[model samples]
Target: MTQLAIDVPENIFSTLRLPPAEFAREMRIAAAVQWYAEQRVSQEKAAEIAGQSRIEFIDELRRRRIPAIQLDLDELEAELNDG
Candidate 1:
């Protein structure tokens, strides 16, 4: 991956503190969380939007303390078998 360097004035940067790159990451995370909570988009779809893999998306959800598991009884059994 390639990275770009950005420059901002000290006062403006200090006021926000978060760098632009970090801010983008946080926004992506926040959007995923909100979409899950309110809009209830599927993990795969949300992950796609966030530019993450399914597992990574799930971990991101867990990091934010969201319950990332949603399975029916059949799905649970399937998961158990797969595990």
Candidate 2:
């Protein structure tokens, strides 16, 4: 595993009520979620990047109100028509 170090303002911890370690974890999850939402990565890859299991990642997506499936209107319509 690769480790990354970033500099954050000291007050950010107090402001967010999160310790450094927790902040780092949250940052990773947030980045993974954003990438997943943007369709830049698959759910499995995002989950790996977030250091979470697939089910946990799905729960995270639910918490963030992001759709787990990426189907658009056209896809939905096609599926409905096919059925």
In model 2, residue pairs whose N, Cα or C atoms come closer than 3 Å (at least 3 residues apart or on different chains), thus clashing, are none
Which candidate leads in TM-score? 2
lDDT tens readout by residue for model 1, 1-50: 56545665667645778876676676677887779766479888888767
- In model 2, the worst 10-residue window by lDDT is 1-10
In candidate 1, position 34 carries an lDDT of 77
Q: Can you give the lDDT of residue 5 in candidate 2?
A: 79
Task: List where candidate 1 sits over 4 angstroms from the true fold.
Answer: 1-16, 71-83
lDDT, model 2: 0.97
**lDDT for position 35 in model 2:** 100
Clashing pairs in 1: none
Model 1 CA lDDT for position 23: 66
Q: Write the per-residue lDDT of candidate 2 for residues 1-83, one digit (tens) a residue.
A: 98887889999999999998999999999999999999999999999999999999999999999999988899999999999
Name the 10 consecutive residues with the lowest summed lDDT in model 1. 1-10
Cα-based lDDT at residue 69, candidate 1: 72
